[model samples]
Target chain A: MDCISARSKNIKGKGQSKLKRRESLAGLLFVSPTIIYFIVFFLLPLAVCIYASFTNWNILSPNRVFVGTLNYERLFVDPKFWKALKNTLFMLIPIPIYITFALLFAYACHKNILGQKVFRAIYYLPYISSIVALTLIWMWLFNSKYGLVNNFLSLFVDNPPSWLSDPFWTKWMIVIMISWKLIGFTSIYYIAALKSIPKSYYEAAQIDGAGPRQQFFKITLPLLTPTTFYLLVIGMIGSLQTFVEVQMFAPDGGRGYGVGTIVFYIWQKAFSSSQMGYACAIATVFGLFILVITVIQFTLSRKWVFEGN
Target chain B: MKRKISPVRIIVFIILLIGAVTMIVPFAWMLSTSLKEANLVYTIPPQWIPKPVDWKNYIEIWTASNLLTGIKNSCIISVSVLVFCTFTSSMAAFAFSKLSFPFKNAIFVMLLTTIMVPLVVLLVPLFVIYTKIGWIDTLLPMIVPASMCNINIIFFLRQYMTGLPKELLDAAKIDGCGYFSAYWRIYLPLCKPAIVANVIMLFMITWNDYFGPLVFTHSESKQNIQVAIAMLNSHYIQQTDIPLMMTASLIAILPVLILFIICQKYFTESFAMTGIKG
Candidate 1:
């Protein structure tokens, strides 16, 4: 009886192992496509980009000759690179402004006011619409002479700034356009965050004689830090990569003026001038810069972001 | 007793009203301009409503630009990529969530890292690779890479699948169902809500993509809607044909606007999910 029981147990063990092996095989088969795709498209391209950045791999040239760090060395001193970086940083000015508006709008809507749904949808409209279409509409709206914006400004001032042509006003136009596009979408996120905060906290604050402003600063603001940090990180990354609007607004890479973002400059160099190697160098540095900034944001967020359930 | 209206509430209402108007004026202007004759576009008061509402610009856009072909190309790219990507991502999600595999965590982590790497970094290398393969002007460059897998969809689906009851799939296996059949017959049906939310998000991103289509395709025949709109803008700006440009912009925005209105719930819900969970 004991021998028979041992043999049965041994057979059961073998059968279970076979089933596990079959499951493993199926799992590997399922993920094979994704693995192959990453290997070919993502990993391979990344390796090639890093390698080519160190060499002179011009698209028009017959051969790519190795020139160690020459591209990187030139990129460090390139005035165009610095100007593009500056413009990209300048684009970040709207992040705080839009986030503030988003928070306010979100707070107002959270009060369950009438027409809340309509307001939410209307705000998110610019975000969903095609950037090209919106940029064109903005260009028309900011038309120096006949634009509705300038026409309105002329009601108060002797002369409105040439929003599209004048370098200074052009920057403000881009900022305004960006803020308008982002505010609604950012508000959606804020609304979600606001919804997640417990009403008990506010009720507690009210019992403690906290005014609306005190309740907001004491309870609401602290709870919303996580959402704010998330938006800030995302907004920073997006600002650093601003391209389409810059390209659409100033097709010449904002040549004499300083309106070109980093991605715009990279696109111009890589595609337009065929400076593939140098563009790769700029791109590599930019990517690393983003990675570093993101890491720093995450680290700094620990100090302020609320981690409560 | 009737509740009294607070001064603060009234102030908030007025502020929201102003904000809503600011958000909508551009779109209202776009529609107004599209209905205006070319000469009336630059009128001094910037006609909020055209003197005589002309629909000629709307009719002229089809023949004057590559709008038709752009729509066709965009549809093809968006549809093909979404269909293939949805299938592969779900399958991968199923495996990651339910099945046991070797080095699965390592592979997933590697895939997640790709999300952090910006597309601009890959531009030079990808452009080079496409040029070498004579795919610079082809839709294949835009379609193929994206169709392989969407990491975001896979990640979202995996999180969703993990929340589903394990006994559901185990019961299917006991009934002699293969792993693929369990995924298809059981998990896929159960995962519909999550999949729909992801599909809507993917559709929006793929449809609204400007940079990918812009960089990959050069020819007028091959251009997508966004690029086509851009081309029309640059081409007509020299002639200052603002009305025609407005008409084209309206046409380009209409499909997305319609989709957003129809799938409004899924759109906001998916965004909220990503924001909070991410």
Candidate 2:
């Protein structure tokens, strides 16, 4: 009986090992496509991108002569690059504004307001709609002469300022457009965050003699920090990469560098001018900047984002 | 208990109503303009309703530009990418969530990090590579890379799959069902809701994607709906054919808008799910 039991145990152990191997093989097989894809598209392209940045590679030119940090040097001095960076940074001004509105809207809708569902759907419309369509609609609406915006503004002020043409207003127009596009989407996230906060917390706050304002500040806002931080990080990254709207609104970077984003500049350098190496260098720097910003946001999030224990 | 109609609720409702109007007015204007004749577009008051609603622009847009071809190209690209990527991503997600393998977590984490790498960084290198491969002016550039796998979709689906019962797959395995069969027959059916959510999201994204098509396709025929609309905008802007432009814009947005409305529940719910967990 002892020998038979021992033989059975050995058989079971061998079977288990074989099953484990099969599982491993299957897992790898399942993931193989993704692995191969990442290597070919992501890893290879990234490697080539970094390597090509050091060379004076131009699409028009045959030779990709090694120019070691020269492209970087030129990028740092390029006025268009600086202006583009400034415009990109300047667009971030509306982040807080839109976030505040989004939060407020979320808070309002969270109260189970009448037509809340409809309101939510309406807000999400601009976000899901074609950016090209939205941009064109906005362009027509801001068309200085016939635009509804200027038409309405004319009733109030003598001059509404050429929204698309005037440098100063063009930035604001982009800002308005971005804010309009983002608010609903951001609010949806905020609503989700709001939902996840326990009803007991708000009840506890009420028991502590906290007013609506106090409850919001003390309990609600703190709980919502993680969502806020997430939005901020993504918003910052997205603002830095702003392109389509800028491209459409001011095709030539607007008058005196009004709306050229970092991506737009990189695009122009790479595709328009065929300065592949220079574009790669700009892209590398821009990518690093995004990385650093993301890292910083992550690090900072640890301090502010309330991890509900 | 009869709840009182509070002033606060009223105030909030009023504010939301105003905000909703602001959100909706642009679309309203787009529709209104699309129905107006070109000569009537620049009126002083800006007619909320055109005097004679012209449906001619709608009919004319088909012949006016590459709108029909644009729609076809967009449909091809969006549908193919979503279907193929959804399968690959779900498969990856299944492996990551349920299966045990050496370096699985490490691989997933590495893939997660790649999400942070912006598309711009890869633009130049990809363009060069595509040029070398003669993929320029073709839909392959847009279709191939995306169809490989989407990291976000994989990540989301993994989160979802982790919530599913392990015993189901165990039972299937015990019944002599292979790993692939378990995934396809049991897990895939159970993952319907999540898959539907993901499909809607992916469709919207791929449909609205302009930058990818803009950079990849140079020819008029190869252009996606967004790029085609943009080209139309540039051309028509010179002619000041605002009505025609509006008609084109409306046509471009209609498909996605209809999809969004039909799948409204999934759209908002998916956003909430991903945003919170993410």
For residues B165-208, could you state the per-residue lDDT of candidate 2 as single tens digits? 99998999999999999999988888898899899999989999
Clashing pairs in 2: none
TM-score of 1: 0.97
For each candidate, the DockQ is: 0.76, 0.82
The TM-scores, one per candidate, come to 0.97, 0.98
lDDT values, one for every candidate: 0.88, 0.90
Residue A51, candidate 1: C-alpha displacement in angstroms: 0.3
CAPRI quality band, candidate 2: high
Best by lDDT: 2
Docking class of 1: medium
Worst 10 residues of 2 chain A by lDDT: A250-259
lDDT of 1 by residue, B1-278 (tens): 23347898788889989988998998899899999988887678777878899989988999988999999999999999889999999999999999998998999999989978889999889998898999998899878988989998888889889999999878988999999999999999998988888888887788788998889888998999889889876534567688888899999989878989999998898888777666
Question: Model 1's DockQ?
Answer: 0.76
In candidate 1, which residue pairs clash? none
